[model samples]
Target: MDKNVLFQKFVAFTAAVHQTTNEITKNVKSETITPLHYKILEYIAVSQPVTLSEISECMHMSMPNTSRELRKLSEKQFLEKVADDEDRRKHIIRLSKKGEAMMNESFQRIESRFIERMEHVSEEELKEIERALDLLHSKVFN
Candidate 1:
């Protein structure tokens, strides 16, 4: 195995992901939202009523950074904080309806553009790539 070939592939993959992110975000032109904000929204939309600490832990972000993002998201009406019934001092973070709608719209628009680029790859090739990615992820993360 050529280390240089693997390194080049890694670089190319990272570049493509960043490029796609920029392209999709450029189309949206949302002044109130950033990529990190959208990522937070994606997480909260699926798992709502979760604590701030939980978000920080799952996202591997510091408490201050997560808190700051949460505050900005709340100000944008993208997230709502609910007082935990059991613990008055704790607040749960959840996506507002507005955030959910935005996320759905963004996903559809981005998916359409991305799908266009996938036309060249055969199903077998896609499966191989998926398996490769899973192996790489397990090696790096596990």
Candidate 2:
């Protein structure tokens, strides 16, 4: 394939992903919590007491951006920073009660939206798409 064609295909793929995510998450009411914020919260909630670096790595976010998002969440009382027992200078992140509640609420909407959207596609098509997506994601991220 030509380079331009490849580039266009890449852009199209990314746009499709963004559109799908927006459709699902746009209805999820979250105050001052962007998808990135929810992503961080979900990660921390599931993997508690995780180091900031670990979260950053898992999210593929820069330290500065992750720290900024963490600051916002901390200010909102959704998450708390706890000093690392092994390293005092480093801090781990964990979701507070508020964060957990927010996560649960948002996740429900996300899951429901996904299911609703998937319902439109035939089972065979859905399975094929899932397999394709898995292959694509593995190639890109792994």
Candidate 3:
């Protein structure tokens, strides 16, 4: 399977993606939240109406710590905690309008940057990239 070659390619791919993305994402900052909090917000932006336990597990944080951090975001009006309609005992968390705007701001920059980067790529290669991404998502990342 050429596992080492595959691993090296993934490492290089991620390093390249992260190099630009990290800088573009840096613009989403606030005096009220730290980088960790920003990451939590960013994660929520992608996976909204998420639950506390899901965030905790995905963020690799303890339940208490996740709750505490979410409380801080909630206080700042960046997120909301609503009772789950399907499961009354559960609480679902979602980004407030402010948080959505914050993430969208960075998203525009990132999208523009990627578009510029892909300008040199041929349409056939772009199709190949799309297929590769789909395969990776379905088989490896899923």
- lDDT by residue (5-109, candidate 2, tens digit) is 988998998999878877777857586777778778877877898988898899998989888888988999999888878889999788888888888898898
Q: Which ten residues in a row have the lowest lDDT in candidate 2?
A: 27-36
Off by over 4 Å in 3: 11-20, 30-32
Per-residue CA lDDT of model 3 for 31-115, tens digit only, reads 6679989889988988887999999999999999999999999998989999988889999999998888877876777787778
Off by over 4 Å in 2: 1-4, 32-69
Which is better, 1 or 2, measured by lDDT? Answer: 2
lDDT score at residue 55, model 3, on the 0-100 scale: 95
Query: Best-fitting candidate, measured by lDDT?
Result: 3
Error of 2 at 91 (Å): 1.4
Model 3, position 77: C-alpha lDDT score: 90
Please identify model 1 stretches exceeding 4 Å from their true place: 1-12, 29-36, 42-50, 53-68, 83-88
Candidate 1 overall lDDT versus native = 0.82
The number of clashing residue pairs in each candidate reads: 0, 0, 0
Q: What is the lDDT of residue 54 in candidate 2?
A: 95
Structure candidate 2, residue pairs in collision: none
Kindly give the stretch of ten consecutive residues in candidate 1 with the minimal lDDT sum. Answer: 23-32
